[model samples]
Target: MSYDKEVGLRMNWPMIVYISLVHIVACYSIYNTITRPHYMLTYVWTIILWFISGFGITAGAHRLWSHRSYKARYPLRVLLMIFNSIANQGSVIHWVRDHRLHHLYSDTDKDPHDSQRGFFYSHVGWLLVRKPKRVLDAGRKISLNDLYKDNILLIQHRLCPWWNMLWCFIFPAIVGYYLWDESILNGILLPGVFRYCFVLHATWCVNSVVHQWGPKPYDNKSHTTENGIVAFIALGEGWHNYHHTFDWDYVTAEMGAIKQYNPTKVFIDIMYYLGLAYNLRRAYPKGWEHLKSRNIRKLGGEYHVVEGIYGIPPFCHRTVTYVQGEGGGGGRLLSETQVDNMSTTDEEGL
Candidate 1:
């Protein structure tokens, strides 16, 4: 997170103050949770709330809305909206709009949270400062016409912070108070504020950590990676290489949820089983093997095959990195299919 490209941008005081106070409250809540064992239940509630809020992003905003990896019935859409509102990273329209921009421009100067600038900018500094004119211009070119069609999305966006507050903060606190006799103060600070803060950082890791670290299976070009530690914490979003290369894949990773901790996929699958989600999609890309082999030869290391957590065993694949450090790749996703459509010639087997 050392890098910074915020040189000419104006500071956003309101966002700065909100973020500053959020961290302060979140840290104080942690201290309270530690010193006051009586708040154990509240702490547990925080963990539970974190999962719920995370789903709103992983399932609702990023996958369902941003990429449309699957279609949801009205009931499911409404539920996802409520779930996302609880997360409050942004309303659906804004989240999808910015996320689409991120995928479109990726690490370029036009990318909203371009990783090329540095980890801090990609993770959270983008919010602290106004975006450069180049980024804002590209963002305008990327349309949100589809999102605007959803009246529910319009309502949420119209209400803005208040809608966010109702679900993310007030509702969680209300639940804690009624369910466990928790005081509104503790409920708000711990589960509402601290949990929100925790999820924010976890979500941000996909932008910063995976881009800088992890192995890139799909290619050896972009800074994206297949990060397991990130997937573990960020609910499978750490499959950055795959997600960036093949955004249509609802599972995000090529492997199923059992191979990784993708509760978000599990939730979507459950929704599908219940007939609330349909048109689930996946991509059938070619040249994965060719790309892997080519990169392996380029990097010039002896090859071995194995499957461990996010490929940490023999530390190699046909061309992808099973372990970490150098010799990996990622790309930008585009269109409703979320397909990069990268082409490669067929290669002889190694």
Candidate 2:
């Protein structure tokens, strides 16, 4: 199956069937809630599962695995792997592969979920249709060497199908059944199917809504934007513009304070304090200030300021050390001012 120019658009039947069934079940669950509401416990369970699965994708797959934003202890890594499986997007390796490609060629033909293809395609249409040759070719060029070195990630990928089924469907349904003492059917429909559907769409919204809406305060070269609504639903992943600009930042935004909606950063911070995570990476203060000063949205008078717990750090003129663990490589200690001056044309432009 391919979507190359010569091959045209080919339907990915497996994905199509899976998505269709989930939606159908979700719709039925909605009707069930309206007509014959389940015990409040069932609703509560659904919301809980939604957060768990959503955070799994945001913190586990996106930040931890894909970006290697920080190092985690073995126990924390295993826990996040379980959460990632429960999210049911894909194995860690597969998710990181496509995500790295998306960042490398975002908003372009090579991007798997290119916004230029329109909202639907970027959101979920890309999944229903086969991957384009350009996307596949680009993905192959991106390195997964770091991920391959991680035993936890490799083990999870090897057993993904089994764990995904267990954590995503079986475990959630069992919890629902035991908590509400309801029919197994009710448990599967409400917490399993409905919750899965909700989390999937919420994650997809970052690819769709985040690109189409919000302000591009980091870089206007891409269509990605900062969407607070999406950040709230996607568990702190909605700061798309900032993310595209500073792809290596563990916080995913310039503002790293906890009072913001970035629960993922908070989670990582907690792990760091507990000695379960370390080498937390973030954008340099000088680079962030430079980008903020030159924000296209601000220049156009369309950017709105939202006060948060931490303002942007003041600019630094002293020499800076460029550490590497966030993007999965060795550190390079360069002069901070020199790096800031060169950042405009460097691979990771501020």
Predicted model with the maximum lDDT = 1
Q: Which window of 10 residues has the lowest lDDT sum in candidate 1?
A: 331-340
- Candidate 2, residues 240-279: lDDT per residue as tens digits? 7778888888888766544346877888888899999998
lDDT of 1 by residue, 1-350 (tens): 23345566799899999999999998998887677644567778778888888998999999999998999999988888888898998788888888999888788887878888789989999889887887788888888888899987888899998999889988978888888888887888888988899899999999899999976657546789877788888888887887787877888877677665678889999999999999988763443444444544433334322233434432222233232233323322122111122233322233
For model 1, the superposed segments whose C-alpha errors exceed 4 Å read 1-7, 37-40, 284-350
Clash totals, every prediction: 4, 2
lDDT (0 to 1) per candidate = 0.77, 0.75
